[model samples]
Target: MDLPQSQLVAAHVQECNFVQIIEGLVDSSHLGFLHIDTLRKSDSSDLAYAQNVNSMQHALAPKIGVEDTAFGFYYAALRDIRKEGESRLQARVAGFIAPFTVLNPNGDLHQLVIPMTDTRSMFIHVYSASRRRSTRSRYAVSTCGWWAWTARHCSDFT
Candidate 1:
């Protein structure tokens, strides 16, 4: 017998009242700058996690394309990739589920940004990718734990 599809493998609810978090989610331009210490990495034996940053895709102003979908809105961030005489557009697509849900392209990650009170918000994150469970879990743990441990030192955003 086959089982039904599960959209949510794990859900984590966190308090992140920063109104700018949503903006940070939608903006690819900050990927290189703000998350210079975080974001982007895989299983690499030689390279340390702290030494890896997806610089190629960071600080890039992607050609944004948006369409009103039945569910809500569909947006694509197109990055230019060229080699020799060849040209291509690498796309990262995301779907906004009306009020606050966002289905991200990678790791089957979905985020729901809900405002609870002034200066307080709940970020509901759901991850569905089961194949790369360990990698995803490590990344999530590093991001949450490491960021929390070092957030106090980050003063540029304010």
Candidate 2:
């Protein structure tokens, strides 16, 4: 059977599919690096470039909370798993996501772990469309790079 649409329409459709695949691949590729630094170390990948903590200490550390607040406060609290250490370490996470649009899912932007079941797990992500002030502050190199990758994919998601 002969098609009525022009060749340009077919080309456009293919282009759109290509873009979606690229975006999806980028999303999935982020999982390994974002979830853990283990893969990066074994592969000698630059993905494990966190500057603030040494690998040995990081391995022993319990958990770290990264937080940003409406009062223009942002910080990270490092908890010691051993509980033997009295001091807690902390730092401010860079950049702010505008309100009503990109605020953290649980009044916070991200969470490392949430248990859904005995074996299965769930991770929830919340994104908004509201606009807010941009500080133009210098963000960490890794953060900036991820933002750049996401920005490109945002055209499809947004």
Candidate 3:
């Protein structure tokens, strides 16, 4: 399946090794705590990404399960959702493609970590939408807030 609409949302040099970037990508537990303020302030009605952020905030200690894939590995962050007195489980699965690529659970976002030197790496974020969807729509930009937050807070990001 080819995505007709795509954007290179962010390309920045991070003051970290590629391995460190990859480690951060696979660690889902950090999302709730590290981005608690932004996630809490997020408009949950905006898009699936916002909703997912809200979910992460609600469930900080999600059960993580990992499986080895042919190329690398995939992991699922399972969280318990209680709504209207009913309980359900929400699983967000993401993949780590060797040697430094992360596949977001939504399947539309991807992060690539390219090593620049011994202690530096290039971090790239890409967002893509299918032909049936408009790239300018809110859905495509759902994660822009997170990227913006990173850019604002990380001095090394540019």
Off by over 4 Å in 1: 1-15, 37-59, 83-86, 132-158
**What does candidate 3's lDDT look like per residue over 54-157, in tens digits?**
76777789999999999999999999977668888999889999988999887777999888787767777777744223222322222323222233223223
Name the candidate, 2 or 3, with the larger lDDT value: 3
Best candidate, lDDT:
3
* TM-score versus the correct structure, for each prediction: 0.60, 0.24, 0.74
lDDT of 1 by residue, 22-95 (tens): 66665555665555445444223233322222432342667788889888887777777554567666676777
* lDDT, residue 32, candidate 2: 36
Cα miss at 102, model 2 (Å)? 9.4
Q: Residue by residue across 1-158, what tens digits does model 2's lDDT show?
A: 25332211000011123333333222322323344555335444332232222232333433435455674333333333232565544332332333212222123233222233332222223322222222224222222132112122223345
Candidate 2 residue-wise lDDT at 98: 32
lDDT of every predicted structure (CA atoms): 0.53, 0.29, 0.71
Lowest-sum lDDT 10-residue window in model 2: 6-15
Give me the runs in candidate 3 sitting further than 4 Å from their true place: 1-6, 43-45, 130-158
Candidate 2, lDDT over the whole model: 0.29
- Report the lDDT of model 3 for residue 26: 80
Q: Clashing residue pairs in candidate 3, if any?
A: none
Model 1 score (lDDT):
0.53
